[model samples]
Target: MLSQSELLQFSRHIILPEIDIQGQEAIKSSHVLIIGLGGLGSPAAMYLAAAGVGEMTVVDNDLVETSNLQRQIIHQTNTVGKSKTESARAAIESLSPYTKVNTISEKASREVLGQFNSSNLTLALDCTDNFESRFLINEWSVANQIPLVSATAVAFSGQLAVFNRKQEDACYHCLYSNMDLPEGDCTDQGILSPVVGTMGSLQATEALKLILELEQPNGSFLLKYESLKTTFQKFKVPKDPNCSVCS
Candidate 1:
């Protein structure tokens, strides 16, 4: 039940046909796991907080660097030396004080990260840069039966996907079956500030869709955005029949 202040705060969402009062309530009842506090996590967490998601567990091992200010919009210039999880938690709290935020400031080990399965976790946002972390998060999501919204950005290109452990869908592990793929971070390849922001914000949108049970978007859909070309493309990620993790 939304109070007067909350109803006023989310009036815009409640008026939309797709997300009226019932949908807004669903959003308020959700618990989301955000697996990184970098570029994608920045906008995703902020938007989720603004949208009134009930709870969030932000996981990050890195500290904010002066160089991260460009795209990690959740952190301020003053938070440069702070842990990413703390920086993000503070930013989310400021946006929506009623939104409970939990911080995991160390490496996202399987034991530590998977512990959140004890809660009523609704979904996971995989904002990590490396495949290893993504795979680990995917494992947790599959094991817990939680849907996952994953995204990545580098230079002018970014990609997003919403995956679930459904018969027709490919999990993140199915997309990267080899596990030996080379990785590139924003430090080496570089990213346009808005490119990452765009993808991260979309992660928040997709999470909302799932939370509210809107249209039931296929879990295998893959969306690509190119800031340089100003184009968006969609594709289907076929599930690997022999996927080691989700098969």
Candidate 2:
């Protein structure tokens, strides 16, 4: 049940015809697990928590290095040596105290991911940079019949998609077919700060739409954006039958 303060805090969302008290309450009861604490995860975590997500679990093995200050907005110079997960937690706490934040300061491996139960986690966000971790999360999410919202950003571009195992929707592996990525992360190939922020913010928006069960129609979809232009392209993503992970 939402308190009077919660209702007041989310009054703007409640005022929307599509999202009233019920939708805000739904958001307050959802638990989302996010992988990675870098460029993409930073904005996604902050927005989701600020929007009143009930619980958020952030998984990242990296620390706040000086080099990451350019695009990793969640961490500050004072936290250069601190773990990314801890820094993300502190940022969320300041925004919304009602939202619970969980930190996993270790790399997300198959073994580590196996510890999470689908019943406890309503959704999983793939903000990891590597293809291995991304595919692993996709496989685990599909195997557990959970929903996975994945996003990738690098070099002034990004991709976002939603996969649901329960509905037999295409998983991340279905979209990529394999775990082989051509290039490395932003550290190797530089990324614009606004590009990463744009992708991360959209990922958070998708999570909120799913949690609130918004009226808008959403299927296997892909959104691509480039920094060169203000326009974004959207396409209907079909499941790849040859996908080893989902098919």
The prediction achieving the highest lDDT against the true structure is: 1
**Candidate 1 local lDDT, 1-247, one digit each (tens):** 9989999999999999999999989999999989889999999999999999999999999999999998999999999899999999889998998799999887777887757773568888999988877888888877777789999999999999889657667888888786566578788999999999999999999999888988865567789998878999998888888988777
For model 1, the superposed segments whose C-alpha errors exceed 4 Å read 178-182
Best by TM-score: 1
Per-residue accuracy of model 2 over 117-152 as CA lDDT, tens digit each? 777888888899988888789889988887788898
lDDT of 1: 0.88
TM-score of each: 0.95, 0.94
Cα lDDT listed for each candidate: 0.88, 0.85
lDDT of 2 at 240: 79
Return the clash pairs for model 1, or none. Answer: none
